[model samples]
Target: MRHHVILRVIAKLGIPFIVLFALYVQFHGDFGPGGGFQAGVIFGAAFILYALIFGLDNALKVAPMNLVITFIAVGLLVFAGVGVARQVSRLRRARRQFRRRTASRHPARRARSRDHGRRGHDRDLLHLRGPGPVAVEFLIGHYNYWIFIFLMMLGFYVVVARGNLVKKIIGLNIFQASVFLLYISIGKVLGGTAPIIIDGGGPVTYSNPLPHVLILTAIVVGVATTALGLSLVIRINEAYGTIEEDEINDMDQEP
Candidate 1:
């Protein structure tokens, strides 16, 4: 790999753009489809390509194993910490709601609550001007949902039924992708635009951005998890001389 001068030069030129693109994805997520996971994979791939061209030792020198491991741990911790904070915030909100005076509850209060519930439901599905039963039923029975279900089940089946470690990892990725689609689907609003506030925008329905933000974190976490799983598989293969589950089991039973 190191002997290929043209390859090395091309990698040198391409790696920077790849990393820049990853950064673009990371920041552009707020405004569009790009996000953390896509960025992380792209960033990782740049270095991987560098390693393939320049040599593993050079890549390791640039990003030591210790640094990589630490970064992974830090990322996981930050993700978990955010989740814990969200849970705490929710609990506080619940307590506040519960503490409201029962005697003061009135029709207006009920109406407000009902409106909030309606908005919540709308966030999960497009709020048609007047969604009749047929429209509701049709949306619920859409082919998008069937595709999501099929991918989820197929991924689960592959993970459960496949013998190859690599196949299992691929299955897990498919399952993750299905979940991503589900969140994106539910977060979409038919007539909604971005949640950006602007002057003279009049009245606007904005799609919820929370799901997208959460998915960004989930995507990064999923990438880390996949990398760790693959590393473990590599180690397992090195130890067992094979990555097939049945072969490993047979080897274990040989003793």
Candidate 2:
């Protein structure tokens, strides 16, 4: 009974704070270095804590698998949609700029073959390099945050929605792996190579290696957590002869 009381206290107090901290990490990531992955883990840890204290059913009621899946999907879609919008806007602006430049030229000057060819070539190149597209690419960098967000959501959905415990672990692994993409994306610089100190630092231009190193450590932690979570699932299945969350709840319901 004392142990039960302790669990209730943790559920009431600890869980709320964990969730609040996760949001802080998520939003504050842009200013510092952390972002979605760190936030996801913190958020996941809160649910995990709740599950430990009050059982999975109650935790699911607070954050249903469907809702979690939706959040993950929406986050990714928003990121990608922004990129596409920027590309379109850039193309329109470039076209307008090109037309304005051409219209201002004298007829005689425009007729000169060499000048015309050069101008046309330059205009074509500018059109090809649309400002919106470039700006979007520049804003997001190369790692593709949208893809990462999608994978993260996919993983989380699988973990929450699946009845099989092992499948859930697999989903968690995918979710965590997605963060690596975000880190890699942000750390990339144009014309930069790996940060390895080989041959007296040839060309001196290289991407930051810190995010990669940090992600590697995060992956290790993710793996450990997955293993532990899976083990617990297996034990739960063995004890109750069911892995479906609803069934487990029914079994645990008071007589």
Candidate 3:
């Protein structure tokens, strides 16, 4: 790689742009078609590209193992924190509303509340909300789901059937990609635009932003997984002198 001066220069020129675009995709995800996963992949690819051009040693110098691990933990904690915060807030609001409603109720209702208690009222409220029917047309709209299924199966088969470590990693990536596609497809609303509100008279439809946001986090996790897998594969090759699963197995079995 060091011998290829032109390639190194081009990589140096291009890596910054790739990283910048990844940041844009990460930030613009709510208003556009990208999110964490896509951005993470792009960012990971930039580092991977840098590693290829400049060498893994230098790449590690930039993104040390401790730094990577810390960021991975931070990203996961942030995602989990958002979910926990939302849940806690919702519960508090629901409790406040319930107290207000119960307080405002008539004598008979108050008597029932005293008898049934807070738990009973909450249980009744949950039971009151029946399951909704699924529309056939709604299911039909997800033509991309079949693609997701197909890719998932292909990736699964590769992981299960292949002996090559690299091929298995590729299959794992494909499997992750299929799941990503499935989530994206599930979040899509036909004719829906970005989930942004405009100060216009026209009623606008916005796609669900949750899926994109979730996928971004998933993407970050995926990048971490990929890096970890590659590192393990490197270690395995160095130790066993082969990356094929069967070869490693045979070597392990030998005296």
Best by lDDT: 1
Any runs in candidate 3 off by more than 4 Å, and if so which?
15-47, 60-142
lDDT of each: 0.79, 0.74, 0.77
**lDDT (tens digit, per residue) of candidate 3 on 1-255:** 978999999999999999999999999988774587679889989999999988989999999999999998999899899999877778767878887876754333433444344254333311333334433433444457768888999999999999999899989999998989877775565677765545564655545566666787787688679879999999999999999999999998998
RMSD of each: 8.0, 17.0, 10.8
Candidates 1 and 2, the one with greater TM-score:
1
Structure candidate 3, residue pairs in collision:
36-216, 37-216, 37-219
Task: List runs of model 1 lying over 4 Å from the truth.
Answer: 1-6, 18-44, 69-141
For residues 1-255, what per-residue lDDT tens digits would candidate 1 score against the true structure?
888889988899999999999999999978775577678889989999988888889999999999999998999899899999877778766767765853244323433343466655434443444568967676665657667889999999999999999999999999998888887766665677775656675655666666677687788678878989999999999999999999999999998
Encode model 2's per-residue lDDT on 125-161: one tens digit a residue. Answer: 1133457777576445533766887899999999899
Question: Which lDDT value does model 1 have at 254?
Answer: 100
TM-score of every prediction relative to native? 0.67, 0.44, 0.61
| Candidate whose TM-score is highest | 1
RMSD of 3: 10.8
